[model samples]
Target: MTAEVQSVDIASPIDVISEPVILTYFETLNAGDFQATADLFAESGVLRPPFDEELVGREAIAQYLAAEAKGMKFQPLMATYGVLETGDTEFTITGKVQTALFGVNVAWNFVLNPDSQILSVQIKLLAGLEELLNLKPGQDKKKE
Candidate 1:
């Protein structure tokens, strides 16, 4: 499924996001460990995508992720651009994402329960690719 288009302030300064849970989320996804990824969430956790239907509960979330992993081919190059501490247990992470098809900016808003389990996650699309997917903004042009 295609993600909804989003608008982001690209000029905002990007800060390094070094959250362990965030890192594990990406790592598990990239590794194609759908169950492991779902295990990171709380039993009744929710996964909200930019375009697709929301998946709630561990079983539903795992099933969705498993299906996506089976269907999609590309792995994204994701870089954390910023993060906001929305509350004591809630945070939002903004990042630049690139894959074989296109590049996009995205945000992952997460809520964690007392046990550090992810209680909910909302994935938002921020923007589409403006430059070539393989060439990051400041990179030099390839020699002819």
Candidate 2:
């Protein structure tokens, strides 16, 4: 059997997103624990997912995450994605994503600052998602 689908808060993956972190934020988003994700963000950090406005700061991130939690369910898939240490204070990560809320598959290349805390998050959804996914601009299916 596949991993049982469950309702997970998108922010729930924060704790597990360690250095060279591999996370499934979108996949884990449920009804609770979003604040946990926001907390992992640097104070002036931002999360940009294509079309939507950039969500900056812990407060704004919390609001965005909370809204996501209320609107959809998550099932962040586990894959052996890798990370690139592009800079002394930066890391780039790539991985798969799926959520009942999104109805599609996605990926993200998160750029974390040297502090090992999230600074900016960029998102992408694989091509097949255009038919069903409702993510932001760059992450939209047609582009991916």
The candidate scoring highest on lDDT is 1
Error of 1 at 110 (Å): 0.5
Per-residue lDDT of candidate 2, residues 67-108 (tens digit): 754655444433222334454233333334444433544555
Scanning candidate 2 in windows of ten residues, the lowest lDDT window is 1-10
lDDT of 1: 0.63
Candidate 1 per-residue C-alpha lDDT over 18-104 given as tens digits, one digit per residue, 9 for 90 to 100: 456656776777677889889999888999987799999989998988976543322223333222243326656666554444445
Error of 1 at 9 (Å): 15
TM-score on alpha carbons, each prediction: 0.63, 0.57
How close is each model in CA RMSD to the real structure? 8.7, 10.3
lDDT of 2: 0.54
RMSD of 1: 8.7
